[model samples]
Target chain A: MTTLVSEAIRAPYDFLAWLVGLWSDALYAVGDALGIGMLEYVFMHHAFLVGTLIAVMAPLVGTFLVHRQMALIGDALAHTAFAGVAVGLFVNSILGTGISPYLTAVVVAMLAALAIELISEVTDAYNDVSMAIVLSTGFALGAVLISVNTGGLAVGINQYLFGNLATVSRENAVLLVVLFLLVSVVVTVTYKQLLYVTFDETAARVAGIDVTWYNRLMTTLTALVVVGAMQIMGVILVAAMLVVPVAAAAQVARGFRESLLASVVLAQIAVLVGITLSYRYEATAGGTIVLVAVAVYIGMVLAGKLQSRRGVSEEAGTGSVAREIDAGTGESTDD
Target chain B: MSLEGIPSVGVGGVETSRESAEAGEGRRGEGTADADRVVDAVDLTFGYAAAPVVESVSFGVDRGEYVGIVGPNGSGKSTLLRLVLGLHEPDSGHARLLGHPSLAFAERERVGYVAQDVTENTKRMPITVAEVVLMGRFPHAGFGRVTETDREHAREALRTVGIERLADRKITALSGGQRQRAYIARALAGEAELLVLDEPTVGVDAESVDAFFDLLADLNDEGMTILLVEHDIGAVLERASRVICLNREVYFDGSPAAFAGSDALERAYGTNLGLGAKTETDSRGDGS
Candidate 1:
């Protein structure tokens, strides 16, 4: 009976599968023309798909976190997710269940996110302190869990730790697709409200925007993005995707929406190129992706400095006239 | 000071207009003085770490009144505003906003608040002036997209604050005075009946400070009840119809002239405040 229900669902799934096949064929044709033979493998296709989805999600959520100066939240959540994965493994061994560790990571990461928020709100502790406490606790828990379950769990944990491209199973890729859609819809629907809260939470509260709810929504979304990115970017380097692309985007973009858009574009470029490089060199996919993102960030910083210097030089032609205007208006302390 | 919770004694048997809707019109006939009172704080007391910041402060702001609250630094000026806005709960007494207990005040859009020097928090955000102003419309928009009417109101608010030209400019790029104006525009865009400003001109240039007060005076003249918490006693006294002198308590609540005449300033601030300068200068010329 369950098979019949699945069969009914299989029709649309098969249609989707067929469409994905057509797209993959087109990508392969491009790869053949470009002479990048690694792109034709089924595992390579999975890696690229997961990477692209992660690229879209990381910066979409990261821009808000970065702007709020909570960039380390992604790192904290990722480490918490590692503990969650350990719990899943331990529980599965005990119960003889075959549940995916990523599922448990999602649950654990979300709880940790809420815990982070609650600790800060209740104690009036700075957000970083909350993050630091949670980070240490989470890493310690994961380490203990792994040590205790060394016989059963030690084999497959490295894939989550450093991310292996070949380890992104079809089921995990499908899960990532679901996560991408969920995150995209949520972030899009709540974009304006989140932006309002992100800019000035006190004013947003005064404006009756349910600031706490949006804050929770943002942190929850961060947890979800951290889990999704973990499949490809790994536990350690997942947050790099969240922060580096946004840092680069901020150097170039003048507005919030522009920054968000540019970050996604930058992340996409980094992910695709990183995946290709990792595939060719048999390197850790997460590290390669982060390295590319960092390189782009450095490039943007240099470019921004050069562009501003040129502007200053052009203003120098007008003597102290430009300087006078700038002096009249106090320098911005935005960063 | 021991960090112990003070028992909050809420006002009892005070019927909200909603609860007593059937008899509200009849009560109005009895002249209970509830018609125009935007804020009515009765013996409000708040503290942090069991040390009182606002101690048994009470004041009422009637409709169309510009009330300026003046106090020395850390004398609970901002804390008093927070109590009225329900951002902080008073420990020992009650505060009502628009005839409802502040915590239960449902008409959120009716009261607007401009916090002190939020520029530090907002500067890093890459938001445009219009977008910041549009946030004022959030309560009215309510899970719906901002309407064209909302945008028009935001634009009009910008025009009112005389920063309509900077509407498209990023908030981080604006001058201190311009940012303050933009914040005022954000509050104004809500079209609230009561505007609560907490030191809205801290970093403004001298020339712009005069202009900022002029804008507030203009808003008050147009019937928006303004509660301004200011450190610039002289400028605020010149504009506000009533002055509320607070130093952890309500020292005086009366006309600005009476505030000048009374020793409340000296008692509250522990000094004859600079408003004395203006008072002495006036007496030197007219001896009245």
Candidate 2:
């Protein structure tokens, strides 16, 4: 059985290697032809599965981040993650020790998230501004560290800058699958609590729902989902996943629950399609997925506008969509 | 859980309200001022700042009293409820539920508070009507899997507010009046002795507003003492038994009849009291 399994693993590699070699050559030709593909095209040595998974989960997670009004925070945390990965790699290389750079990245990402929260609380300024400042400062710190330790691939950190699915690894794929499951389960179990707090924080508080802890928990989860699994996708557009799907879902969904479900479904579909297209055309998966999600959002807006010819949406758009549904249905929303 | 078996914990509790309501009912037989101490506040001077929203606002609400808190928009009537619920610390003076200090945390079990705006956080996730109501049981939703008794209480709370069908509906989807009912149901689930709602009828249709007032009246009849902070002075003059006015200080605390029978309230409100309106106010002010 051991020999059979060993043979099974060895046999697939012959064809896999051939396909990869040909695929890499075609990618080089395409990049050369396009005149826009960056220098990182040489390492067509990535896991397609990992890139696809990242494409799917990033936006799915991004939806919650956007809803929670944490997009800029996401961007900042991704930058901080670079520092974490670099530091971890630096330590491992210097000591001739073995440690996972990505796992270390998760710890640093969490600290960055925590720091952002603390800073936001102290500053009381608009959240996105703080996130931007944190992101720039974090990346600067990472750059300094990279400069201090110029042994390996700092210049080749285009995956962190301009994403390349061709460089995603097996570890990245495993991490992503785990993070996705964690996010999915947490969301499902606390779905109602999240909904209540989101819709009416004050009422939830009055009703004795602890809004503070849940808010922190959600951010913590998003940080984990982002940094733990980001190797599959890259930092160039991590916030896209957190924002685009929900933005699109909100455009179409009638209510909050519908929005959540729609966002997840839309995100998953967008990622899967983005992956297949990226695979076939050698396009950037993150960019393609975000673009598709935007396309879906536009479609939702058009569909909604087309459905309401009399501009009932315009009227209710001022106050609430609930009233519009009630108006159209003739169901005396007599509250 | 059986209502009887549920040991009252928070100030928003059935036992507390029932006792207070019964005590209020007992006062009707006596018909004397000595028995009118449903909610006793002593030397109360509280607000957001040193200026004080409620200063020397000394007063007592008799059991089963329907008290209306009215004044101009910034008069601090809503602040008074927050003080009562112990959500805010009073700068000075003292407020109490029954006989306990206003800051008493456990005393919250007897006080059900509804705010002017019950909006979603817009950042958190959605929760169902049933689950929102069950939040009243936060003190109880522990290792025990929200027992059958807790579910029954939640259901009863919904039925009491006349929104039983909306148990599973999202709070974000309900109409304003229905949403208010859900809020009321949450309070009832807590079994509050004093149900306090700030602007319970604001922005609701007149019919829905009337329905809400009517429900509060029914709760009042069933021995629940209600303290309402409202902008709809017209309906309030008809509903509340005692009226308290605040203008950064206690202006008036008395029966609705005093407002209807005299020119004092008309002058205070800065509106001419029409003859027919006075007659209508008198009829409703003298609670059955």
Candidate 3:
């Protein structure tokens, strides 16, 4: 029965791996044609694939999180994911078993996500005090666990901490594809409810959307995104992908749907450009991506300021007209 | 006073109007006989701490009735609204919305809520006026896709509220009064029969407040049951057909004219120290 259930899940991952192989070949061909040196290597192909998926899902979940003032929750979850990776490494060393640390990280991060939700629910507020405590606790646990198993494990930890472009394994890329599918499908199904809850908790409740259930779902999805992005983004800089793009999008987009689309587009730019720049400069991929994202954010802020300044006079005139129309209709309705 | 296994108290203070007297009896045994009672609270009590914020507040709002609940700040007016909407569970007794217990009330689309300037808190959220209004149809659409008919209803609601021209504009860019209208349009798009507003004119300008009340009165005339909770006594007295003066309990529940004639406002507001002091003791006795 267990094998059957595992097979059901494994079949999709196998197909995704096959798709990734095809993508690598296509990239190789394109690299030969366009004379792009970086795309010639298989690891670089995996890196780009992983980076692209991270760009899509990170900001997709991040848009809701950023607007809701829960951006810190992403940073908190990433720290906990580091603890998860530490636990996986410790267990593997002790038991001499071949288990993926990313798999364990997913489990541990999801647990931390629920713990955060539970604490908030019990406290009757999402205070930063509890979040800060949880974050430090996760990091402390990871540090302590890693210190206890100090040798080859310490060397490999740098890849998880700062993120290495050359270390993008095929299996890790496949895991990200699965996470991407899960996050996107859930968000698509519950977009309206999530938007309502994020925008106005009271009205959403009165409208009969179970706000608590949706909040839990949101945090859990954030955990998945954090861990998946951890491969290319690393534990330290993973959260920037979740926040910077969304912040930039909010500056320019007029509507929620527009902001969501814009954030995803902006993140794609950050990821693709940052990856290329990282390869050329021999810089850390996560650091490069975050730097690019922040640069984009600065550009958007300036653009938003200029746009508002230009529209100020036009807006003032229309504002009065709108109010006058409201008053007129009110009087006409009063009989 | 015990927290556990407290028996539901019998209904009292149902004398808001002749209609409510009948509705109260309908609640006791006849059930569906008072289908017009859009909101009914029988000895409802709740508090965050030990001292109950709202205590034994019993009243019934029949269809098409314009009811206004006026009280001082921290007098549990908003908390009472939460109870009626089933946002918080009552410590005891029952609060019903459209005949169902508010907590378990399933037909949510029938009731509309216009909160006190939700935009003040969510000012930075990037949502257009059209998008916000479309949320009213969310309860109806559930997991299904929002159809063209839903969009049509949302558009009609925006037009009704006189913000059809500003449909594409961002909600945060609008003034306080305009934001409230957008919220009302959202409620209307859901085709709500009972429109509930909690201090809808908090930061609105004086002229817009008058216009907002006029719009509300017009909706009331069109057979919509309106329940408004406001701290402004004069506004409630001038606009609402029925007035409920509350401070921890139902100090007075009757017509606006009767409420104005009586010292209900003074007692409820605690302006008349002697009467207010006496009433506080009396309510505490009743609560315990």
Candidate 4:
């Protein structure tokens, strides 16, 4: 049946397969001359490609979420995706189905995202309360399913928990690409609306923008990002990738666009460095990635404090001679 | 532009006809022209639960009227502003904006609102003053990028509030007065005719309060209809052409001089509280 389906959709899949194959082989050839043949493996290629995609997707959505003070939602949805993966595996073993758990994760995570919005809307609960409710419920359900799994279907659960670079298959890589494009397009198209809602929701609402609908769109997009990133970032650290990069960028970036752009650049660097270090050191990919992001965040915080202090000192300078001395010292330091 | 297509849904009068007319007007960038009333509340009642916070409130804000609503704490001053802004649906009766019922009113660019507690809400947000002001153009721009004209409007608004120099400064970095001016600039940038501000001077300094009221006066003189929900009754009476004293209902709706001389203030304040700004010393003395 798998072969029949592949044959039916052969042309497009073949094109994608060939394109990725050629791209990876070209990179491997370059890596061979540099004494870095690690890129030769198909799984390594998948890890890097999917890792890059997640780096872009996570922070792009996370910027708005962070500004709106809904950062915990990312973690909540990631846990829900974990439960979703458990449910998929459980159902597959019970029914002898060959369904992909990642697909189920996407469905479950999006529903949970909507659920968070609905719960907050219907009740007077704070956003964090709703998030905590969903978070605990999701993890508990995952635990229950794991405990109930007598058919040994939970074997791959560890990979989803802490993440393994080798586990991101070609099929899931394709899904990540689709998710990346979807998230990017949505964010780019609705950038202004998102900015309005993020900065001042009441004003945005009065301005005739459908605040609720945009909010749901944002959360659903976050769910997509989480599910796509879960393979590389894992359920536990998935939200770190979403938040840490944006937090670091916010320390320095002057505006939202700059914040988003800088966050993507920062996340990309973290993912690349983390993946390479993990491959070299035989470390867990998710933990390595999140640690790198945290380091970057710390570095940015220290730099921001130093910059603000300098600004204050420059303002407190007495006269033109002190200002000239300050400029000279600044230029000398630049050297 | 005429009020022919203005919606009347929540107001419940010829409502179905308004629904059909609004479908066309909603697309038109320029909505209805002035039909006198910028904000019209007729027997509006609202509450979070069983006991109504505001009940049987009724008033009309004529075009170019700088109407100040004054009330005690929890007297539904903010809620009434929310009702006029279409943030909350009333339990009964109706509120209208630009001659359209609040629920169906969708001419967003024509109206701007500044919420209370904005400074607290935006404490950690990393947006600049210009960016905050640029948000006022969101309604006109929709899902699109801000145009040069939008930028110009934002700059003009900043100039109007005398904070043009601080446009690039981060909102969190501004002083309380500067922050309040930035908020006013945000509302002005939308090119709104009706500006509804809730407690804009709550956290501002004493000097900035005078400047802020003066700026509001300048805007009102320039033909912008202002609805200010203020705690400072004496200050509001000095600036506003009309005063609406609300304690869940319209106690008095008339000129500042009329409200100053009327017994409505004594009744609302439960004493012979001086409503005149000139009697400031006497009022303060009486309160003490």
Indicate which candidate wins on lDDT. 3
lDDT scores for all predictions? 0.79, 0.64, 0.86, 0.80
- Residue A134, model 2: lDDT of 72
- Name the weakest run of 10 consecutive residues (lDDT summed) in model 1 chain A: A326-335
- Per-residue alpha-carbon lDDT of model 3 for A227-279, expressed as tens digits? 99998889999999999999999999999999999999999999999999999
Q: Name the best candidate (by TM-score).
A: 3
**TM-score against truth, every candidate:** 0.86, 0.70, 0.92, 0.88
List where candidate 2 sits over 4 angstroms from the true fold.
A1-72, A86-99, A126-129, A147-153, A177-189, A305-335, B1-51, B54-63, B92-112, B118-182, B185-194, B205-207, B259-288
RMSD of each: 7.2, 10.2, 5.5, 8.7
Please state the CAPRI-style docking class of candidate 1.
Answer: acceptable
B1-288, model 1: which lDDT tens digit per residue? Answer: 000112221221122112222222333454546767888887788998789999877667778889899978899999999889887778988888988898777778788888766768655666678888888887888777789999999998887777776777677767677777788788888889999999988887787677677777778877889999998777766788777777786665666666666566666666555456546524533432
Give the TM-score of chain A, superposed on the true chain A, for all candidates in the order listed.
Answer: 0.89, 0.74, 0.96, 0.90
Model 4, global lDDT? 0.80
Q: Which stretches of candidate 1 lie over 4 Å from their true place?
A: A1-26, A29-36, A307-335, B1-33, B271-288
- The DockQ figures for the candidates are 0.24, 0.14, 0.59, 0.25
Q: Tens-digit lDDT track for model 4 on A50-118? A: 999999999999999998899999999999999999989998988989889998999999999999999
The better-scoring model by lDDT among 1 and 4 is 4
Candidate 4 ranges with C-alpha deviation above 4 Å: A1-19, A314-335, B1-34, B272-288
Which candidate's DockQ is highest? 3
lDDT of 1 by residue, A1-335 (tens): 96798799787666656655665677788778998798678778778888988999999999999999999999999999999999999889888988799999999999999999999999999999999999988889988999988875887788888888888876777777778889999998888788878888877766667777888888999999999888788899998999999999887766788889999999999999999898778888999989999999999889878876875686466435323332332222111
lDDT of each residue in B18-55, candidate 4, tens digit only? 43234224423434344866887777889999999888
Evaluate residue B285 in candidate 1 and report its C-alpha lDDT on the 0 to 100 scale: 30
